[model samples]
Target: MVITEERIEQALRTLAPVMRRTPMVASRALSDSCGHDVWLKCENLQRTGSFKPRGAYLRIAGLSDEQRARGVVAASAGNHAQGVAWSATTLGIASRVYMPIGASLPKIAATRAYGAEVVLEGEYIDESLTAAHVYAEETGAELIHPFDHEDIVTGQATVGVEICDQMPAVGTVLVPLGGGGLLAGVATAIKLRRPEVRVIGVQAAEAAAWPASLDAGAPVKLATMNTMADGIAVAMPGAVPFAQVSELVDEVVTVSEDAISRALLLLLERAKLIVEPAGATAVAALMEHTDLRLDGQVCAVLSGGNVDPLLLTHITTHGLQAAGRYLTVSVNVPDRPGGLSALLELLRDQGASVVDVIHSRVAGELRLGEVQVTVSLETRGPEHQVALRRALVDAGYLAGE
Candidate 1:
């Protein structure tokens, strides 16, 4: 059960044919903002659209002949289900996966396509996990946990080895932490080889459990957790990973939901990388906590990219609003024939792109002859937003945000 340098290398050999050596790309935008050489470990591009396959493959491959015959079962919301399904299919083993009813349709289809019987069970992951455990107990099937086993951690450690091989001089590494499989694995691998390199773990602020767990010297389960980063919203740290993370990880940081959305937006716009919120948490850490002033070459692991398109649209809009790139303003103008026309002219002159407008004359707060107009405008950024509002006020319109 002891994960070491030799075992991690063995994992690389075992995964060579199944997994990819995901690209390590330099990010000019991140580098310029952080004031350091920054690179992105694009595991988002990994098979099954995330790094889950690495651990899933390694764990299932080590099963005994009798165990393989009994098959494997796992519970997950999305990414891990597909990972286990894909890995099991590749190894020619029968696999059954339980997913929460709310799991995205595309993810469910993907898991089924990977040759696993996908069962929709429960409303959340905890319920699915319960069902999976029961199935395992009854059928004598091996239960493949997402991130709580030594074999899983050892498999994930291969990412750290690859990072070191790709960027030999990396001074710091940032990883997204949920149950800590990836963080624990990467930190162990890096620290064992380059003890001087610092490893930081990032988690969604709303779902963070490690800070409290580390303080209590054990895994601590939360009563509730709400975060858009479903991939890293683990309510409790796994016992196996908690042990390694407490010793090998240099620091653990939490990023807000707003920061995660903004980071995802930046990754899409600047780096042209499609990353889920959990994958963007490390980038969010870099965007936030400006006081950290990280030194030397830094690498942030982009954990996964299997985001639902509808969620992507909503988060993109949320990010835009947070960045002040989109604004909604209310104004009262004369209820005349040219009144709305004049307002449109003003917006045109200010170079503001009008996305929506609602004009009403029966508003409760409307004056005797005035009408209320709600305008949704898209601007260049915060500074442009300020200028546009100022222009609205100076132009003799009662503008309010």
Candidate 2:
């Protein structure tokens, strides 16, 4: 059955005590940037730091007494595993989760903390899910998919219901799509309530399957999916979710890796919020949308906040490079100490902060007595970077043209 309004309402009631309704926080910075009244549905604050718990709780709540006794099994990259583990434990039911080997450490640890048996299996979420399905069939444990099921979609639709209640003025909803469960549910709710409001789905360009799936009107698996937004890195949309997304979703947009990193940096630095790459994908769409028509009261669902600390660090550095604040320059100077000192003095005068200095006496086509010195500097922008290079050149150091 399709996700109905009544089903979503019941799911909300079932999950009321277990799930956080989360906040709809206004972002002046985002609004000013996009020229829209932007509000973030911070599902990153939901139980398990993701909206996955809503669906998982509702799915577990649907299990019969017999199924509950047999326990439940699920597979996910990270967020969905934690969601299922937490929900099963809350209901006093035993749970087992199979996760990809590449799943984040924080997610695996969180799943373990929720009183579930964690199984690290396979290379990607699909493989893990396949293993879980086999285990469930062999052991008779109930299978709770991260998406694809009606109960899960209905549970995810609760977000749409809460958004309507919290912000009746919301005219558009932007959501990140992996298997499309969240988007399907939200689309059903908004379409049923106010068919006028639009539902837009954002996917990582590097790992986009929905675009082709929607065009073909079927779920097509990808041979590979390479994206930093691991949360939405599904190789193919689910059968059930594909139907709903193809039918209800108004548009499916893709965001580049660079755009996602930039959005994550913006959310962290300017909004003071920690959003994973997948969670920030919707905001990335808002920033990079070629069409200027989506500028009204827009709500972007931040689906999860489970980024690894290492990934966050990389995203920050990459964002700096993307924004032109960081630059690398190669300078040819005499292989002497004082020669490097003179170049440093000019850089100091140019107001550029030196992040790293690598001097090599024997590499990259250097002259007999001259060494190649690469200076990585932090500058304000193109202008500051230009001035820094100019100052270095005016002093007779051969900075790369």
Candidate 3:
């Protein structure tokens, strides 16, 4: 049950009415920076705020009446849960979703709002999936494997169809790779139609498994997975996507956490698009590896936009730090009141905006009549950061002034 051009076309036809034809947004900034005309395939704006439903809807709609009557069960980190819930409800089928306990609140709420019975279980997607499989077996319900199933991959291939149609002269397409449904589907669809076009899959470097699996010529489980791009943090590759990715994908690459944060910030600032870290992996790949010879015009798929507000704030700050636009400096000052004021005045003269300041005298390292001050300061860029730190040192604030 591998993906085929016909299957993908059928999926596109089936999903057209429910799917929003997300636009190909041109990024002048990225285009100029990368030395190519860059376009963003905004699946982040797709139904359920992701490309999940294209596959979910198609997978569910194909189930027989009896299968549908028994209801459906699924497990996901977040996006796929909402997708399966939305798709099943739209088809008048009862759905139950098992999600990791750490799944974001908004995603859980959205899944429930989509008319699915949401159960919080396990600490990660793999555990939740195990629970979902058990539920399916016990209840005799159909299990909707997020990216592992044939129908799901074929359905996700619709994004490739849209890209092929939208960007007539596209030379390279970069897709965020996780379990590989999107990559497998999109690569197959595009390669089948436009064999000349390059399709690259980008994964979160910390949790990436595809590269090792491809090297071994079989699926390999990661010892540990850690990344902010939770959307693509699969510990192991899916059977279907593994097969598709191995055979069809032109290249598989990785992007760092800092790169992902910077890419997300860039999307928010330049593209005015709110994309989750996982969704921004495609762009991150380009940012981290600028030397890739993407022959002509490039299209990076912004995969999803379901992010927690708290996480967004943290990532934004992290991005700023990674870009050298923010800094946290620790200094020792006199324990007297005027000492802190003098330090503040020095910062003011240096043109650094203080975000936060923590003054403490509790550290064991503190000398007699002295306190430690940790200041979170915002700067312009790398050069400004260097100048500010130099100014702090010159003022003796950094060396116990």
Candidate 4:
């Protein structure tokens, strides 16, 4: 049951024809910010738009013809469901998937497109998983777990092999920890090949499982986890992955939602890579640390790219706000219509791009016959924001930051 380098190598060879050998690209921005040689393992570009396909394909491929005929089933929020569905379709096996009702529309559509019967039930992953288990028992379908099985782990190990081949000088590998299939397999392969290399696993601080689980020396379940990184927002750690991670991984860290969002923005703006919140977690950890800076050649695995369009927009907007590139100012002006026009003209003269404006005369505690004006504007950076604020102050109006 042990995952060794040879087993990983074998899986890589078997999966080569079907799966993509995703790129390992250097990041100049990450390098400049972290003061180290940084490379991105772009598993976001893998088949299924996530690394899930590697394990899913390997697990189904190992099944016998009878097992395949009996069909396979799985429970997931998104990525794993798509993985199993796509793998089953390619292997000509009937598959069924149980997913939370709130699962992303694109993922649900993609899973159905891959020829799996999609059952939407439950408020969270555990509920969907419970339904999937009952269905499997009644229908006599082979259950394919997302991260807990041996074949799935072996399949995920291929990533480590590829990383070693692509970046031989790598001393540290940062992995996003979810249910742990990816980390367990990748850690096993890395330790088996180059025991000297350090494997660092990261989790979203809001939905983190490893911190408490590792402390208790067993897998612990969360009552509820709220985080934007839905991909790694696992409520509990897997039994198999916990064992492997405990033994092989050198460190486990947690990053805040703000940190993850900032990292996501950095990837999009600086690295020019589109990554989901889960995918940006590792880089978030590396960026969050003020004391423990990663040295030498470091690789951060971008786990997936399948982020909701709305969430992506929110993340980008939030990033701009966090960076002081977007600002909102409130000022009191005369009730006359020309007052609003004059204020806007002053903003234009100061080189600020207005995004939104609101004028209120009916509400709030204000001087009689005076109107409240709230303006939202976009600036180039902190300097521009400062310039706009100074100009507003010099123009004889009270402005709030």
Rank by TM-score, highest first. Answer: 1, 3, 2, 4
Alpha-carbon error at 52 in model 2, in Å? Answer: 0.4
- In candidate 4, which residue pairs get closer than 3 Å at backbone N, Cα or C atoms, i.e. clash? none
- Model 1, which residues run further than 4 Å from truth? 399-401
CA RMSD of each candidate after superposition: 1.4, 1.7, 1.6, 2.0
lDDT of 2 by residue, 1-401 (tens): 37777887788789888788899999898898878899999999998889998889899988899999999999988899889999999999999999989788988899999889999999878789899999999999999999989999988998988888888988889999998999998888888887888899999998999888888879988878899999999888999888888888889899998889888888888888899999999999988885745835999999999888988999989878876789998888888769888888888888889999998987878779998889998989878877877777777775457
lDDT of each: 0.93, 0.88, 0.92, 0.89
Worst 10 residues of 4 by lDDT: 287-296
TM-score of every candidate relative to the true structure = 0.97, 0.96, 0.97, 0.94
Model 3 compared with the native: what TM-score? Answer: 0.97
Which pairs, if any, clash in model 2? none
Alpha-carbon RMSD, candidate 2: 1.7
**Which rank order by lDDT, best down to worst?**
1, 3, 4, 2
Better TM-score candidate (1, 4): 1
Model 3 Cα lDDT, one tens digit per residue, 331-350:
88999869999999989998
